[model samples]
Target: MDILYTIGAVLIFAPFIAFLLVVLIARKKMKYQSIGLAADLTTFLLFFSVPVSIKAIWEIDITALVYLIAILIAIVLLVIEWRQTKEIEILRYIRQTWRMYFVLLALAYSSIWAVGIVLSLLHFFRI
Candidate 1:
């Protein structure tokens, strides 16, 4: 159980590394498959990393905040689509919301890492 927990924690915290490893393994099997695998893994990893990244950089737990924001985004998108098309499209709403989360989370993850790296380097140089 302890080993399982350790592995899970590592995967959760080091999503980008895990993503690369998975992509490389998939690539060895099939080039086309790897492309799709990479896309899927990126989104999946972002879901875990977004909250972890936000917490690391901000020193605040944003796990619940991310979910709340996602719900709000879905609501806003549904309203706009309904007003324009005069219909409720569940599938389209899901796709748009998912893609939005992926884009936003990817940006957050990368930016947080960039800021962390910069801060670390600055601190190291100061000493």
Candidate 2:
């Protein structure tokens, strides 16, 4: 039962994790290659799966903490990347694209949160 719950959580939150990694960390590379994007997305999914699974098993209230930490880390990384790679044109492009990325990420997060809430309500009502 625990394992199944873990898997479900992982399957739920995979895409948002992928978007975070590719947008925040890999955006500075010169290549902007497809392989890098795939790798980051894979890594994001893998890491995200584990934590979500653990949370499901433990019944943790991590909603605020997770978003807070993610937003803080994202801001820090963006500031650091901007400061360190000011001369790179790719970074400029990444900065421009980040707006779209955030919008998509917000939409994904909201959808996931809504689904989770609905599921929890259903479970509570024994539906």
TM-score of predicted structure 2: 0.36
- List candidate 1 stretches off by more than 4 Å: 1-3, 17-41
* Cα lDDT for residue 98, candidate 2: 47
Write one digit per residue (lDDT tens) for candidate 1, span 35-110. 5556556777777778887777678998888889878888888889889989777877776777777678777787
> Which lDDT value does model 1 have at 50?
80
TM-score each candidate: 0.73, 0.36
**Per-residue lDDT over 31-105 for candidate 2, one digit per residue giving the tens place of the 0 to 100 score:** 466445644455445345434643664566555665565566566766776788776466654544444344444
Alpha carbon lDDT at 56, candidate 2: 61
